[model samples]
Target chain A: EKASQLQTQRDSLSQKLQETELRNTELECQLLDLEQRLENRRLESESFRKSLRSLLELLDGKIFQLTELRDSLAKLMESDSS
Target chain B: EKASQLQTQRDSLSQKLQETELRNTELECQLLDLEQRLENRRLESESFRKSLRSLLELLDGKIFQLTELRDSLAKLMESDSS
Candidate 1:
């Protein structure tokens, strides 16, 4: 009877082990998927940052051109008045 | 002797179950941490996109102002020559 009880306990433990292993496998898969998603986000953010930097540079150039043009207009107006 | 052997088998299975449970716990913790990191990345990306959209709007306004200024300068120059 004691041996039968031990056999039952062993069976229960084996079942629990199987369930735990299955759960572990599922968690591992989830981890992999999450990691991939995170990597994609990092890449996307980097690309966005690069594009933003270039756009800022273009704006700077346009602003500088505008300043020069305004100064030229001012000088011409002053001379015309004189 | 057979009962003794069965007891040994049960002990080994129990030990394996304990180990598997421990591994599952670790994997679960890893999953939680990864999920948090991914959420942070998403929020950061959203913020960056918002800033980029505003910057583009600013650039458009500047360009429009520049065009107007250039046109005024051109008209002044043409009238002066005439």
Candidate 2:
């Protein structure tokens, strides 16, 4: 009877170990997928940053040109009045 | 001798089970942390998209104003020359 009990306990532990191993594999797969997604997102963010920087620079150039034009118009008006 | 062998097998399996269980717990913690980081990254990306949209709109407005100013300057120059 003691031997039988030991066998039963061993069976139960063996089953539990299998289940845990399967769960570990599943979790590992999920983690790998998540890591790849995060890497892709990081790359996308880097592109976004670069695009934003370019847009901001373009906007700055436009504003500078506008300011120059406005000053030229002001000077033109002053010369016309004189 | 057979029973002793069985007992030895059971002990080994039990030890393996414990190690697997610990590893599972560790993997679960890592998964939880990765999930939270992904969520946070998602929120940041959303904000970045919104900011990009706003910047584009601002750039559009500036271009329109620049065009108008350029036209005004051209008209003034033509009238002054005439």
Candidate 3:
């Protein structure tokens, strides 16, 4: 009867061990998936930053061109009066 | 002399015509530049819209992933007790 009890206890311990390993695997997979998603988000954010920078440059160029045109117009008007 | 006065008037008229042509050319150049800039701004705005769409998709995906994780965790806990 004691031997039977020991065998039953051993079986229960092995089953618990297997359950813990399976849980660990599931948690690891979840963690890996989360990491991949986070990396993708980071890359996307970086690309957005680059695009914003380009947009700012374009705006600055447009503003400069507008200012140049205004100055040229002013010069033409002055020449007309002279 | 009357001929001298006529000659002076002709020179003034020709000078005015040249000035008008030059002004027209300058205005045309400015208009073309403005149009090009406007086109560039439109294209940039479209690109920004696309980026915004992509960002929204990324946010939606992340939210979905988080919801899935929450559900999985809840299921895991429920199973553990059972």
Which of the predicted structures, 2 or 3, would earn the higher DockQ when compared with the native? 2
Q: Write the per-residue lDDT of candidate 2 for residues B1-82, one digit (tens) a residue.
A: 6677778889999999999999999999999999999999999888877887897798689779968978996898789954
Evaluated at residue B58, the lDDT of candidate 2 is: 87
Q: Is the docking of candidate 3 incorrect, acceptable, medium or high quality?
A: incorrect
Question: Model 2, which residues run further than 4 Å from truth?
Answer: B61-82
**CA lDDT scores, all candidates in order:** 0.86, 0.89, 0.65
Q: Across residues A2-82, which tens digit of lDDT does each residue of candidate 2 receive?
A: 788778888999999999999999999999999999999999889978987897798689779968978996898789954
**Could you tell me which 10 consecutive residues in candidate 2 chain B have the lowest summed lDDT?**
B1-10
Interface RMSD for candidates 1 onward, in order? 0.8, 0.8, 48.5
**Which numbered prediction scores highest in DockQ against the true structure?**
1
For candidate 3, write residues B8-76 as lDDT tens digits.
555555555556556555655655565565566568758978987897798689779968977996898
Best by lDDT: 2
RMSD score of candidate 2 (Å): 2.7
Please identify model 3 stretches exceeding 4 Å from their true place.
B1-82
For each of the candidates, give the backbone clash count: 0, 0, 0
lDDT of 1 by residue, A1-82 (tens): 9889988988998888889999989999998998898888789878877887898798789779968978996898789954
**What is candidate 2's TM-score against the reference?**
0.83
The C-alpha RMSD of each candidate to the native structure, in angstroms, is 2.6, 2.7, 47.1
Q: Residue by residue across B1-82, what tens digits does model 1's lDDT show?
A: 7789889989999899889889899999999999988888778768867887898798689779968977996898789954
